[model samples]
Target chain A: MASHGLTYDGCNFFRQRLLLSTLSGKHVKIKNIRSRDDEPGLRDFEASFIRLLDKVTNGSRIEINQTGTTLFYQPGLLYGGSIEHDCNPQRSVGYYLEALLMLAPFMKTPLKATLRGVTNDPTDPTVDLLKSTSLPLMKKFGIDGEAFELKVVKRGMAPGGGGEVVFTCPVRKTIRPVQLTEPGKIKRIRGVAYSVRVSPQMGNRIVESARSVLNQFLPDIYIYTDHMKGVNSGKSPGFGLTLVAETLNGCFLSAEMSSTPQGQGDPVLPEDLGRNCAKLLLEEVYRGGCVDSSNQSLALLLMTLGQQDVSKVLLGPLSPYTIEFLRHIRDFFQVMFKIEVQKPLEDERKGGDKVLMTCVGVGYSNLSKTIK
Target chain B: HSERESDEEEEQGALKWKEGLQQKAAEAFLRQQAAAPNLRKLVYGSVVEAQESEEEEEELGGLFRVSRPQQSKKVQANTLDCSRFHPDTFHNWDVEEMLDSIRDCFVTGKWEEGHDAA
Candidate 1:
């Protein structure tokens, strides 16, 4: 393992660089973070993220210059007992939860995280989407039990967020290698149309329009309408839809769209939001793979950490985020994947080209896990 | 007879290029197929590496540095770090043809010979 600190420029993929550094136990230095921009420094959300990282680990050293343009982090052991965090409302809880999902399984103890902030927003994957898609994907990697769950305790929208969610995960000694090449035919589509601080009819309208678009292909589509009022509802009025297509082989492809945050942009009609979100699901299906677009990097990260065995996952075209993640994986783990493109047969109508990623895991075991 | 023989030679010479047309086309197609989808290179290519080295700064009067507005690549490096992959705008989902492209993904669509809805 290379103990020397890695250096990076700018703030893009900030979470990725830090997350990998923590997992690899290597120190990292990042500079020139929006240095040339006006009001140059780390944003509030990033500072909040760093705080969350500090809460999860023990003895981690973090230093930021006065300008917040430069940051140095030396990660400590992942001490993942129950922790509470007030995630910055600038980004959703999904932003924080994504990092937690990756870190939770390798912790010294079972993790119970109470995250508060926007649960549903346009910028990141909503808590609902992660609950529906990411948990199942993790189960395929042998990270499952009764305790492994993510529950949305409250609903919140962006701008003035007041949402809360509780996520729990059991620690694993060694991640299981998986061969997930086939994403069987989608048997059913399930969705959640949720509205907070708005008319309950908004959820129903979202469900109706979403089903109208989805019913063209499958009859087993059920969208649940959830309307939270009073204390459970967050500080803003918004509605959103999250749809998941479940394949027979236990693969899930998901898509979602949240209404524009209040006072941030043009308000969207629930009907339009539903229809557009449904179309986004179709687009996801067109890219058809064993893992949905949002969870591609997570799947790959697990593959990298699995016991020294070959893990293969068929994925759609790599997203820009996933591409950068691959580069960072190479930088931290020294793992390179064998990338193969699989063109659909001429007669098949199952969307675009697929890429099969094949790699041998580095057999990263949790040294912190206490043997029972 | 001599004139007819000369005309036959001329005809054969004129039609010579047609002899290897199919083979030439196949070779060209193979060459293209080999060059088109190098996924490994595309993912870890030099283009991404080039971004890291393009941090050239201009100085004014040997004291003040000119901070020109960032180019697209620099903007990407400093953009929000979100994981949600937005759908490609080129795919207009309202079009029937676009919807038809992914029809076979559902259970209602055509299944392979061995697999049944059961």
Candidate 2:
């Protein structure tokens, strides 16, 4: 098989095909299968089998679906019941097995993500503003590990029975069951999560914030999100989808675009013809876009965009309608997020996620303060 | 072709600056984003290569970051800066009040009842 380095262009190529929905654009569904044996080999073998098939096919699609006791199957299915039959290994090794699938030839996984609305942040990553923590790098990455993004349409119980999580992403694959050090037995380690929702109502808060903050901090973010909006078919569920907590630090600038997956309806180019097929396919993520965690520059940009420090740049002084929108936003955050800004990063502070929110306009005050 | 060239220029420019908020943003914004929580902040992606030893991490004073050096300078506010762009929009402040009350309830480090429901 050719060892072409994976890239955003390759991603775009797949995206275009998704838009067309050509006959050859098959989607490989990663349905969680119920298995008793917790053998690492079995896991690797299954993932490898799917990947190998992907290599043979010209360019296949991927659909990531996890199962547990509460898993739902679409009519007559190949895998049934919650695949989380074995509680420990299922959570632990199972995730690992699925992730390694990305390295295989058949594993051309489409990056999946969501966009949370922009909000005020006063503290920015500066030289100062933070202390430190005892979390190991791997564990930190595990709980909030940034890597090849994998998204799925999950069906499960919501936290606090907040309705059904339904289409939530659930957990990132990196976190797993581990044997606790020092005293006693074993338990599963938990990781943090962010949710996102995009809809008419969602535009009110998250997208509204994105309009201002995203434009100021991460302008390119809007470019990418807007460009890809056509390919994504994700539904807007009133509430915003939470972002991966790690990316939250820098996604200061946000935007919404009408994205359509790459290929709406078509076939592989005649010259593009090849004879391989893969089972696991990637799905196009639309309005709710997440940054590819592997791109280091993007993380930096997100932080800059979300930085609480007020840098002036003809941000507004717009028409009455736009100004009213800003007014309502401030009122909402003050009452809702009640975000606090503590020890704002001085202009010179260097390193740290020192930015904080105080639910006050101070987060974006400096220049705007005089505006009103 | 022109677009690719501009991107290269931007990337090169990003690489040259060593320290600044914009630089940090440039770094973090370019990193990978597989999965994360909501409240985390500006952090760039690294290769995820394991360190050689415990002492090595400590040797760097635990200040080693995998992303590129900072590459931005704080833009001094011009007249009608970004903040002034949308000066009047307001939102529901009640949610903030609720969270503040919940935070106050957790005098200790534990969640009490539905304290964390928000």
Candidate 3:
């Protein structure tokens, strides 16, 4: 491993830089993190993320300037085990869990994490979306076992988060390279319409309206109505819908929407939220890839780490986040992917142009996994 | 339309083979090039130029700096970190043609010759 470090500017792509740095065992320095903002520095959520990172690693060195405008991180060995974290309410637990998912398989021990905070929010990829989509995507790369699961213990909405989730992943010595050119046809559309501290009928209303949009396409549409009450419902009143379209090849693409957090702005009707979320699912199907938009980077990371084989994935047009992730992969592992666009034929009813990404993995293996 | 125009030109010429066939081929090639988006260039090449725009802060009267608070790209760098990709343009699902665009993605829709719904 090269002890020499890399540097970046701004706090943008903050998690990507840090997570990749840790995985690649490279030091990283980030400068001008909101340097010109009124309260210029790393936000509370970012600090919480750093604290979480510190807990999972051993011998890591982190430094920040007095104004918090700059950061230097020397990553340590991934020391994953049973751990608990109170994720900052500024961002949802999904934000922290995204990085943890990347680091978990390489850890010294199987990871069991109890994360407490917002479970569903409009700002990030919510917990339900990840459970339905990303975990399935990971399983394609041979990360599945009895221990692989993400369970939401309590329902929490944003702003005044009080939810809890437990995530567990079995360790892997090597990631499997995948060739996922065909995503297969979606056989069923499944979802959860959850309302917490709100009318239970809200969940039913959401399911009805969402089914109205999706039932035209497939007969196998099922949306579960979940109404959490009492202490299980978080400190706020909110409702949201997460829709996952399961394809024949076990690929999962998801879309979700949450009511405006209490006091944030104008509230949305459950029916409207349901209809919009269904439309979003249609949009995702139009994007039409083995991996959906949000999990593009995660799939790319696993591909990059796979044991020295050519990995190929068909994906939607690159998201800005995924584009930056590709650049970071190049920077950290000295790997660049062969990208090609496959346009749908003139009469084909498939959605848009797809990008085929081809890369040879770095053959990274988990030396930390202890042999029992 | 371009192909039709070329057909008209071929009819107008005494010898169609001598009528700028190479030029027409080059034009068609250039048109194809323009139509296809280069994904590799968009992902890696354009990011550098985007970051350079942030450096163009205008100074105001040697006392204060002019801040374009609404420069969305500049703000996006420091914006809330999220992985959700909001669509740039949404197709109205109410329209039949829009719905048909993705109809083949379902098991109920068309399948390739070798594959069956089974």
lDDT of 1 at A146: 100
Model 2 chain A lDDT-worst window of ten = A275-284
Give the alpha-carbon lDDT of every model.
Answer: 0.91, 0.21, 0.91
State the lDDT at A310 in candidate 3. 99
Candidate DockQ values, in order, are 0.63, 0.01, 0.58
**Which one is best on lDDT?**
1
lDDT tens digits, residues A1-372, model 3?
Answer: 688899987889999999999999999999889998999999999999999999889889999999999999999999999999999999999999999999999999999999999998899988898898899899999999999999999989999999999999999999999999999999999999999998899999999999999999999999999898888898889999999999998888889999999999999999999999999999989998999998999999999999999999999888878988998999999898999999999988989989899999999999999899
lDDT tens readout by residue for model 1, A67-172: 9999999999999999999999999999999999999999999999999999999999999999999999999999999999999999999978899999999999
Ranking by DockQ: 1, 3, 2
On lDDT, who's better, 1 or 2?
1
- Give the CA lDDT, 0 to 100, for residue A306 in model 3: 97
lDDT of 2 at A42: 24
Q: Could you tell me how far off, in angstroms, the CA of residue B72 lies in candidate 3 after the best superposition?
A: 9.4
Residue pairs clashing in model 1 are none
Interface C-alpha RMSD after superposing true interface residues, each candidate, one decimal: 1.0, 21.8, 1.3
lDDT of candidate 2 over B1-118, digit per residue (tens): 9999888788986766654778788667766332332221221112242224323445654456333212110111011111111213332223433222212111222333553423
How big is the positional error of residue B5 in model 1, measured in Å on the Cα after superposition? 24
